[model samples]
Target: MLLLFVHSKAQTVTGRIVDSEKQSVVMATIALQTLDSINICATTADADGRFVLTADSIPLPFRLIVSSIGYETVMPECASYAVGDVVLATKTNVLGDVVVKSKRPILNVQGDRIVADASSIIKGRIVTCAFDVAKYVPGILCKNDNELSLAGTMSTTVLVNGKVWNGGSVLEYLKTLPAEKVSKVELLYNASPDMHVTGAVINVVLKDNKGRELTGQVKSSYYNNHHNTFQESGSLFYTTPKWSLYSMYTFADAKSISRSQYLSHHTVGNQVYDIDVDARTHSSSLTHAVYTNATYNVSDKSNVSLSYNASFSPKSDTKGRTTNSYFSNSNYTTSGNSYMHNLHLAYVLKQLRLDANYMSYSNDGTQDMNYEKYENPTAYSYWRKQTSDRFNFSADWGFPLWKTARFSLGATYAYSKTGNRQK
Candidate 1:
């Protein structure tokens, strides 16, 4: 019993020593080399074709080379195969598929549908919004309208932090959230569920803080076009750990500094042939945003999250125009801004998920056209507000989509209203 105890603790090599044809070769030399230089072990195969040998202090990269009469010598893992595991492929051309390894990705390996890491935009990595990120993956494209299309289909429904922004186009929402804040983008392909189907499906996965404890970054940039932008972000988290309370908080702020040239040639007149001319005009817009999310995990497989997003964009413009008719000329200037938000709570247990989402959106915009058309052109001003509430519940059921893939179905309902508070 004492000898057996020692044998179990030490690494053992037990297998058959065979010829090139896999026929048992008795009396063949089986050498086991230990890196300790002084330690080495050897044995001979039995008549029944099996051998068991024990050794102490054997080092890694142990190799077994067999040679016998009239057969080609073979090595499993070679540089040709790239199987570099020392334990499985120690010598020439030895390859073992059962061994686990890490290598350069030809495709996404695990964890969700895919993984995308942000690189510096100056390095040709342009991550402007959801469309920019979506363009990085295969089968996703950006349309002329700045909308996202996948698999030849337009309008991809998007879910951010587990709530539907449902703004027809997610380009606006994607711009509000920083690309660095996103951990993964799940391509919900051929979705049968009504709640997530727009024409295609996109789920923006945020960086989870549950196990991270703390993480975030800040960035600022300048452009050749006389524009500047800056951003700041941070996150704090505490997983249940050994106890049973989980909490996480994330926040980000961004201010966009942008400029543009608005040049137009115009013709306005009582005479059908007579025309008006134009000159140079310039416009600048600034946008600031704040977004936050708080999540609490109640138990091992249960949790709830609350999130808020608020943003505003104010634009200013200066203009001048000249009409060839009577050599008329005029100039005008104005500014406008808008805000939007989403509030939500959610729960998750196993294959079931439930959530309540409320959203408030407001926009006020104006443009001043100084010409012969209006008797008194006070900047064209418009303001609107909208509110929406939605309850969503879903459960997972396994159905075969193909021999290799499965189907997951879910549903949702929403109530909403829109109004013009100021006209």
Candidate 2:
């Protein structure tokens, strides 16, 4: 009798909703109530369309309803049971899974060369010049003012975004260009091909130009030193998909104060001269630069580009110098002026680049000498002029290695002849 009652109750309760075939239906409709009562409770099915109620203890004559979009409604009551495959006889709908991903840069790898992106996360505040960038890069060193050394060599060929930017010191150049514009600054150790034996090579990669429209920036700054001094500057940039343009101009006026104390002893061949002295110096300079560039898509694999850059450094100084020795003694003074001009041009290819640069720098200054000797000697007043002319040309080639690696080779020839005359 119990087995018969269980079988009868199982037939009364039913559940489940699906599409044609055995696929589950999502969000179907379900209803439940007392078997003989008109009152009912209805709710939407869950994602799986499998609904459950008090099937173990429902009053006799209780009823449950199941229905789905465009499907025949199912009615059963009084006991516990489960049913499925209430497959709809309608058309099927299909969906695809959505995916999310983002891009990032890679760091720390094994290779003979080291690439230091000037814009890496390692960069920090107080990075006002290339020296600050060098501090974070391995195998790069800047020992003193106006000095750029690489690896073990004293002379290095540095390129700014594949272009020869010889207008100023490397550190000054880095300052002129905001660090944000830098994408990577690479240090190539012992340039390959047994012949480049000069200093190591450095390439400063800048951000690429995109967008079909226009964009740029303008900025100015002030700099101060230990002495009461100050300087100011401004710059701008713009770009487009078919062409690009950039122009920057900077100006500085400054003064410096310093004190020095020293003692020395000299013995040369058969002569000896010992001297002690204290000295102070004050100097200033006015400098500025303007640059412009453009590119035209001559073909798909090749493009033509031209650029011009000019800067002026007019230096004037007032120096007071004194000399004291056993054989002769003198107090001297010097005041002077100097200026420089530089120009450049280039053409580029997909795998190669060619460029030429010329510079004419002149220094015409006077060295005034006054003398007071007690050793039976005489001195004369004097002045002098110095001049320098420089020219440079280079070509670079990049070759792909087995479609995975890349090799870049380049050659540069530079000549700077300088002369000084005194009268």
Best by lDDT: 2
C-alpha RMSD (angstroms) for model 1 = 20.1
lDDT of 1 by residue, 1-423 (tens): 355434435656666655434566543333343322221344434574455545554556554433221222222312211222112112233367564322211123122132333332112455644445544543344566355644323355666644566322345445544555566655443333534443346666665444543333343444333434343333232334322222222232332333333344455575344343545444565555555556776676666776666565645344444443444455555456666666666777755677666666666555455545446543343443433344444443335667535567666666767666555
Residue pairs with colliding backbones in model 1 are 75-93, 76-93, 76-94, 76-95, 77-93, 77-94, 77-95, 276-324
Models 1 onward score TM values of 0.50, 0.58
TM-score for model 1? 0.50
Model 1: ten consecutive residues of lowest lDDT:
80-89
How close to the true structure is residue 57 of candidate 1, measured as C-alpha lDDT? 47
Identify the candidate with maximal TM-score.
2
Deviation of model 2 at 3, angstroms: 98
